[model samples]
Target: MDGRSLWRGAVAAGITLALGIGNASASFLVPQTALPGKNVPKYRDPLPTFAGSRVPATSGYTVSFEEFKQQVLPASGGFGPTTVWGYKINGNGPLWPGYTVEATKGSPATATYVNNLAGPGGTPPLLQKYLTVDQTIHWADPFKLRCMFTPMAAGCFDPYTGPVPAVAHLHGGEDKSDFDGGPEQWFTPNGMRGPAYRTYTSAGAPPAPANGAVYNYPNGQEATTLWFHDHALGTTRLNVYGGLAAFYFLRDDRDTGRADNPIRLPAGDQETEILIQDRQFDTAGQLLFPDGFPSGLNGAPPNPTVHPFWIPEFFGDVIVVNGKSWPYQNVEPRRYRLRLLNGSNARFYNLAFIDGVLRSAPIWQIGTDGGLLDAPVPIVYPGRLLLAPGERADVIVDFTPFAGKTVTLTNNAKAPFPSGMAADPQTTAQIMQFRVGTTVTGDTDGTCDPAASKKSGNKCVLRTTPMVKLATAKGTTAPGVTVATRRQLVLREIEGGGGPLEVLLNNTKWSGIMESTMGTTNTPVAGSTQLVDYWLTELPTLGSTEVWEIINTTGDAHPIHLHLVQFQIMNRQPYQANKYLSDWMAALTAAGKGPGDGPPNPYATVLTDTLSIGGQNQVIGGNLLVTPYLQGSPVPAAPNEQGWKDTVVMMPGEVTRIAVRFSPQGNPIGGSVGYSFDATDGPGYVWHCHILDHEDNEMMRPYIPVKP
Candidate 1:
């Protein structure tokens, strides 16, 4: 049961990188000059914004998953019309960067999503499939479950060998389990379905349409920027990478009201919502992804026979803005609100506006993933807005100062994040260019309200005074409060005979065993003493508050995400990881469990559903793990990150303490009764890394909430 023994001697050298039956590798790469092609054809002129065909909660709408063409790059670049999949309303064409669905709080919205895509062409129709679906990993197989034996029996599904399966998950939504768009609820275009398929309907209602689902989105939580993306089991990375993601916003009286709203933020055209993604295109103008069975690792083929085309991370060289490569936008010299969402698979962005040199303009961050902050935090010149994949930042950028000059938005974040190699200058460095026109589009709001201006007459609508702070809680606990429960969990990466075979959440995979009864009668069968299969370990009591301490033992900084609820972050502290791990492993071995069995939870009050666990600079040697690279000091939450957040970054070698509540009635702020629907029900919910690749692998798990 020792963590070291679970993966010890798993890596067997000398495995050939030969192509298996389903192995693949990258065959092409875009020319280096193709990057920063800022002067490409000015096609796809006005970026499209979907405001929803019908007002949310009023009527149901339909979106068909179909393929279309877009002038992604200039024709001069020879990358002609590329066939990409997107959501279309009313049978419209070219809905790249799918339309935004708008809904109001407390109202329920309905939508029928249909899969109308055709399989790839071939002798008998090759059945368009996920080129990066790792068959060796645990996935959604239509047939039976395959179990691998180690200390315990761990199960996975066979590789999907048919037409592409698809489903949509409304990330950040608190919808019912039936409408949550779980990974197992996938359906193929030919009517073939997975095991967990369900019709999105109420009790006694008619079943959902065949090969489609009628999703009921209960907009019962705070108004925030949520997105819909494919959650099909093993191929999530390939599907989302194939352009099946869009935005959805839930509005409320607080976020947008007449007199009752305390915060009067920018609205309409003044506010621009953009989806930022990274991609690579083949010379034939087709979407390109790394072959599931690659022939090499970090340039040297390491046990290619293991996972031929599977790589730990996917980094694209081209910066895609709203589906256009290195696209440019013309802006009038004034204050404009930018809602930036990192929709990429793995790339992180340290965003900044570069004129000619390093920095020119300041970016004022007013909101985060969960919405408005207490006040605007000015990111001064040369400051970088660090955004991890799946993270969002709402900011106001003033173009008045650089009216005639062209400023380029740039990124400097390293690949694989913090400790990875620096990003390439020519490709990942430049994002998009902003051409500030000489025309002055003055603020027409006609309000001198201090809540919307930097000064008396500067005329900034959202740079208001007394910025609205929706939620803020930092420290061990909220002022004048007590925590009902506390628990500790660890994140680990398990190596295989080839390389990293899988990553585990609490040292468990997605299985049927209930972790809440691990040592009891519900535990795994005899002789299977290790914890490798998924078990329901965390069953938080409804209407209660608890502290969760996430301990990261791996080398990579993982973004930990929870479902159904958002949490606030407390403070992060450094620990003697080496000593603690040794003791923890000993305890687990004695109990006949893995290293994730038990550890005392630290009490801290911070809110977020997704947090980045900072990685420590540790060296892994034979039977000896050293942690001398641990930082001497603890890391604090960023100032802009003190507000309510669904996700936070946990640095390596750090213990991130978060205070989470099951019901809103126990909120630190003015409380509400609770959720509108039942918290404990159906297939339940899951929490995992927001990184698409990791989620597709073994880095995700499921948890169910139960009544107290």
Candidate 2:
């Protein structure tokens, strides 16, 4: 790296100091549009605009804003278990309560969301009004200028619909702040206001907070299939379990661009949205969960540990999809586009669809929560998809190769993916039916996968974008901090009673304040009004790479995620299992221990959004070529996250390594070794684990490059 000053950088801090860890009360928002003047939905085939377009025909079963509570919902039923449970990311890593969402060409677009939360010793309910909370929801696939009305207390929880607080985030959207769902940008069941508070004041923080919290999103980005759900306070997991969630289909070329897709649109049964998730059924088919704090929370209170089961994570005993339990869908001789989301609290899935039983290679990976990648990568076909909580992926599976044959979408990625969590025998045999018909959907087009599924993380997508090509940064240099500057982040586990629930960054729990305590528990909120603590070290303008070694001292696996950039896995080693047990548990646990290990010197593996770091060697390495976004600045976007990005995950015990540039384009901030991005009140970006629960619970930190 050459040409610039010896230390250029910017600091954008404020996100780490403003997050809430209290129990949540969030739910769905009100409608944003009026119903058609006529009884039926007044949608245009080519009516007003989009006359001759071929986007998903938005003409079927659209319930207008007015007819919400009266005609549609009560008739549609409230909440229940998912149809199938699979993976979105893969392995025994982070998983989600899984299920399927289907949007056909002509059939009524419908989705059956499942609540996989378990309660009172892991039993589920077969009855109504699932929990003790009062919550309800209404969703729109697209963001309109209006809000939807919801009777929070009246639906499932008690007091039936009150003015419950709420908001909607089309996970993937092209909308406005008024429409982009932010934690702060929320309203109550009684229609209190719009996006009132961005951050929630957590318990145990120093008294006298300055302001309420609120969040805002960049709604103007292109659309990818997203969803609307509750994100208020700490109880996000519970509210979603109450059945206050829905699927979203942002209006975009992805839908209309179906023609160009290697996987054909649904002409028949060959295609369907395979929403895989896990859930527990009470004696009455009702969703269940025990109250109080999950294990491992930083500043969780001492008393009130009610509720049992419904642990931080859930893995099911059955598979469901599109309202059918291990049900089979008829498929034509064609390929299909499967958009997968991991809707769960804390579970990781390693998905692969099989040609026969649970034994086929993966097809390919074309998209992620962000959007489609240029090329496709191959994986072991789980005949299913993998996803972590709040994670999603867009895939294309070709049935043309296996035309006229009966196949099964089976899963072998055992629980605690990354292969750790033990599975109950009955729960491990989950499978779904995929019968192929002689009929082809359309021209069963070309495919990019002879192999692919959710594993080795990033493949199908090209690591280098056009930006990298232009800068002429052909061969690569390892990423690093300024030669004289280095930073180390420690992954810790805060233990108390039951098994540890989650891991934390830097020993801090998702509680407290950054300026005062600077403890592990204190993490700032994401987007809008989160004042945070950050450090931007300085160096040369011709920026030099720095070494960032992340150490983990926790028991459970953690996907230490960072936002805004992607890096290469430099090297990794497994920590000694024996030492881990001794440090993490009682004497009984120490009886059976094993030798710890680390990646061989300069260990190099695959490139992925996440890196799993076990106890061995206990060291994870990373480097960043200070790529600056400033024009005329030395760092370029070539090796930076040229594609639109804001988040990436690091798996547990994997000791993953990566190379990152400060600027999405070049190296070094300005002519210095450090620099920052321009901060606007709105687009002020932050990063954290893609695991929504982790982000909510505080495992997120913020940073901004600054000029000295």
Candidate number of the best lDDT: 1
Clashes of each: 38, 200
> Which residue ranges in model 1 land beyond 4 Å of their true spot?
1-57, 90-94, 120-130, 145-159, 203-207, 254-264, 292-304, 442-474, 512-534, 582-636, 665-672
lDDT of each: 0.60, 0.34
Q: Model 2 off-target regions past 4 Å?
A: 1-163, 170-185, 191-228, 243-256, 260-272, 292-310, 318-325, 355-361, 381-386, 423-425, 428-431, 441-487, 514-550, 560-649, 657-697, 700-708
lDDT of 2 by residue, 99-197 (tens): 112233213222111222222333322211232231211111112111112211122211122223344343433222222334444444223433223
* Residue 540 CA displacement from its true place in model 1, Å: 0.5
Deviation (Å) of 555 in candidate 1: 1.5
Every model's TM-score: 0.80, 0.54
Looking at candidate 1, what is the lDDT of residue 371? 59
lDDT of 1 at 68: 66
> Candidate 2 — worst ten consecutive residues by lDDT sum?
3-12
* Candidate 1 global TM-score: 0.80
lDDT of 1 by residue, 46-122 (tens): 44443233124336667777766776766666668766777775455436677777778777778777776555541
